[model samples]
Target chain A: MSRRLAEAFAPGSVAAQVAAADWRAATRVAGELLVASGRTTPAYTEDIIQMLEELGPYQVIAPGIALLHARPSEAVLTTGLSLAVLEKPVEFGSKANDPVRLVFGLAAQHHDSHIEVLAETANKLSSPRFVNSLLTIHSESDFQRLLSDS
Target chain B: MKILAVCGAGVGTSVLLKMNAEKALRTLDLEAEVVAMNLANALEVQDAQVILTTPDLVAKLEGTRSEVIAIEGIFDLNEIGEKLEKALG
Candidate 1:
């Protein structure tokens, strides 16, 4: 069976109230979680940063969420997800979606393996109740339960 | 009708845009085929009636025959639907 959004979450990757100095810092935190989960190498983090430099703030996909990622590369050992809820929102320079508080780091080994989770996440985020729950997530368990709920 | 969702990498954000655009079209009761692709591939497609992409990528699609719509957020269904309605009408 294909991994769902909740199943694709790397162990110990969900965090709450993380402190980040800026958008780069926020992305780094998410990348670190992906590293700790054994999903990608340290180089994958830099790849994501490089993508940001090249692509601009297009990762800021919603009002308060930034989905950080790059094209699937060898740096990705396996597909996984890292989520962080910022203690203080940071600007990613997107005019429509500035002051992002939630960052999701995605590392996919292929073009399509992770699409299910991505689509699931997008659908859940469209719900105001789900967004509210995400903003108030107090623990990793809270985040996991939130994902499973929807 | 066809719509192309364009992004830098094609495989990531554009997929999200394509999904939301599908939902928006469904709500609007409009029928169209939406495809997700990278910037380079999007530029080559000639039959698409509309192209949905981020604000930054709007400039990159300068000469495409399709009408380009710049969406503020890929997940914002209301924004996508409103823009699609105006563009299609």
Candidate 2:
């Protein structure tokens, strides 16, 4: 059951790139990637941007972790997940855990159905070993292996 | 008992918090219905005895009659349960 959810990270399919200084730029890049992957539409892409604008810099759980989300309205064409590793960590008001280097953006349509997936992702990301692995990962295959073994 | 868990999307962390809070309440033998919703949906969800959310959203919930419990660490189950118990009591 755990592996079923973990397998969502496609080894070679995971696209990674160094983001510019701005967080919004990074979100747009991820949104574009999702659209390119056929996970969402152009309209949905704009919705993701609006969501970040309205609810963003979600530093409430800050200090290295930010959970970026939006309403399940016109923005989400389908349930999707994507990751962005900032070249330089950015601050989102997480004083206790400032400077977040990794961002895992989640989009979903249902309320409670995706809870298990988010919980699993949070548990995996919260681990020191897992995060360290992500930092060192150079290829999509490496990333997928990390999820597989996690 | 009904509890409203609010966050940015009402889809991600808030839902997780709701799950953890529900588990905690169940451990205490408290019967409750946890409804996860966004801050925009807060006005629609009436009859909730307590509100669980981050400090930012809680601030916007000012002047409302609902008992508000501002949870700093949404992932910390202990803090969430403690705040929930105090607010709902």
Candidate 3:
């Protein structure tokens, strides 16, 4: 586990049932969570938006989760992750996976520096238990428990 | 068998899929080199037997020579592994 990743997904990173009408709003909320935590600059958020505009909305990797991110760049302050669950599910143009409920926004400083963190997240996400926890967690402490236990 | 897990960005989504691919391979007791590549570099996968990716990105490989298997439930290891077994067979 990267120390940077630990800080990024730390206690305060989880937001419960944010109101987002669409992918743009959901992504904005997730990016704002990271920005509020000082993990990424405003430029990082804009970069994510720009990437989506340039490349379509293909970030929804799983059925309910979308891993929102841009490439490693100067816009990032530190490698980190922030997750937001939406009150209403939003579509991100995924054919197999739509109405994504969770957005995990990530920012890395280097291209491959986040492989370990990505791998860890991938491992945890495979579990129905953990993913279910993300959907049900109601408080910051609940989020923290899921983060550490998973 | 040479497999390629592809996504929009080489480093982000591809990396996660690569890890899952590797785990699926291990669980199935199979041996293969799984390389993660971005859409731009997807054309370089001529030597690859199966290309695993999402549905949106699969269209980008419509004319490609390699076999494209669009993964359903992209985050589920069991589903991905089952698809891998079918593809490998």
- Candidates in order, TM-scores: namely 0.90, 0.86, 0.83
State the lDDT of candidate 3 residue by residue for A72-100, as single tens digits: 77778877788898888999877777879
lDDT of 1 at B58: 90
DockQ of 3: 0.50
State the DockQ, from 0 to 1, for candidate 2: 0.57
After TM-score superposition, the amount by which residue A41's alpha carbon in candidate 2 deviates from its true location, in angstroms, is: 2.1
Q: What share of the true interface contacts does each candidate keep?
A: 0.54, 0.54, 0.52
Q: Per-residue lDDT of B1-84 in model 1, one digit per residue for the tens? A: 999999887777898999999999999999999998888899999999999999988998999999999998787789999999
Per-residue alpha-carbon lDDT of model 1 for A70-104, expressed as tens digits?
Answer: 77888899988899999999999888888899999
Of 1 and 3, the candidate ahead on DockQ is: 1
Every candidate's DockQ is: 0.63, 0.57, 0.50
Q: Candidate 3 regions off by >4 Å? A: A1-5, A10-12, A53-56, B77-79, B82-89
Residue-level lDDT for A141 in candidate 1: 91
Residue pairs in collision within model 1 = none
